[model samples]
Target: MRLSELANPSRFNALAERLLPWLVVATVLAFALGLYQALFVAPDDYQQGATVKIMFIHVPSAWLGMLGWALMAVAALGTLVWRHPLADVAMKTAAPIGAAFTLICLVTGSLWGRPTWGTYWVWDARLTSVLILFLMYLGVIALWRTVEDPSRAARAAAILTLVGAVNLPIIKFSVDWWNTLHQPASVLRLGGSTIYPTILTPLLITAIAFTLLFVTLHLMAMRNEILRRRVRTLRLMRAAAANP
Candidate 1:
């Protein structure tokens, strides 16, 4: 179907429902394979040993945290610039999910660090920037809740989302731009991946699984948002009729 067709809430809802079952199957299969590889097939790190297993989870969470925001940023543009009906829904639904993933990333990163860096927490540039991202997600959620009018809330949140997007680049490049306890990029970089193929393969598979999981969750949230708005509209209508 054409992209514009999804601007219609009903069409979007129908499409989401149709795709959800397939997506769920794909997500489950991907997770099964990824986890099996991560747990049984991949060898432990020479240095970090079994602790390196954390990377399978931590890396995916970190990636999805960033991806959720990036998706929000695009939806924000749709809300403010194009005034697409579903854009706000997309933007709003993404915030809480994104925040959850960001929290996971931070917690796992800290756990990984404790064994490696001999500390649970450090105010490294990369870590600080990701924290800021999580906070921004909270701010956007609060902003939406504070405004009663849907249009007004969408506009306000859109601007906030765009402004918060500045943090994305900062989070990505913080390790490169400053001296930090965090290690440099080992997966995606200028000189290809530094990680060995055996480990890299599972990590990549896990990343794909996490990505599919995110998409499935995001689509489900959007569907819920559409139903919620309809219910809200009906309630307002009934209340107005009773009062009038």
Candidate 2:
């Protein structure tokens, strides 16, 4: 089906219902296999030792933190430009999930950094930008709640999202932009990945699992939002009938 077609709430809900089950199954299975490989199969780093194992979770969380915002940006565009039916739902539902992932990324990075960098936290560019990203997620959620009308809230949040998106590139390139404690991009380099194949395999698997989990959660959240809107509409209608 076309993007325009899916913009209808009924069509969107129907598609979500059919896909949700398969998403859940895929998410669970991928996470299981990914965890197994990351814990047992992937080789430990020579320098970081066992502490490097945190990469399995940390890297993926960071990826999702950025990816969630990127997805929200697209949804925001849809709301402002196309006024897609599911756009606001996607944008609002993504905030908490993105915030959670950003929190995980920060905590795990701190844990991994302690042994590697001899510090738990720093004012490094990469770390600071990611912190800002987390704050932006909170800001978006706050905007959504503070505004009473859904349409106004969505438009305000959409504008904020677009403005905050400037940080995404800074977060990605901060290590290169400044001399920081954080390591530069090794796996996603221009030439090729520097990581060993053994370690890379598990990292890839775990990342996929995390991505699937994010999608599943987003879909579920959207579904709930739709139901909540229905309930609100019904209550408003009943109130109007009672008065008239």
> Using lDDT as the measure, which candidate wins?
1
Per-residue lDDT for 64-172 in model 2, tens only?
A: 9999999999999999998888899999999999999999999999999999999999999999999999999999999999997888999999999999999999999
- Model 1: colliding residue pairs: none
The Cα RMSD in angstroms, rounded to one decimal, for candidate 2 relative to the true structure is: 0.9
Against the true structure, candidate 2 has what lDDT?
0.93
Q: How accurate is candidate 1 locally (lDDT)?
A: 0.94
The Cα local distance difference test for each model comes to 0.94, 0.93
Q: Return the number of clashes found in candidate 1.
A: 0
Best by TM-score: 1
TM-score of each: 0.98, 0.98
Candidate 2 ranges beyond 4 A from true positions = none
- Deviating ranges (above 4 Å) for candidate 1: none
Error of 1 at 14 (Å): 0.5
lDDT of 1 by residue, 1-244 (tens): 9989999999999999999999999999999999999999999999999999999999999999999999999999999989899999999999999999999999999999999999999888999999999999999999999998888999999999999999999988999999999989899799899999999999999999999999999999999999999999999999999999
Give the 10-residue window scoring lowest on summed lDDT in candidate 2.
3-12
Worst 10 residues of 1 by lDDT: 182-191
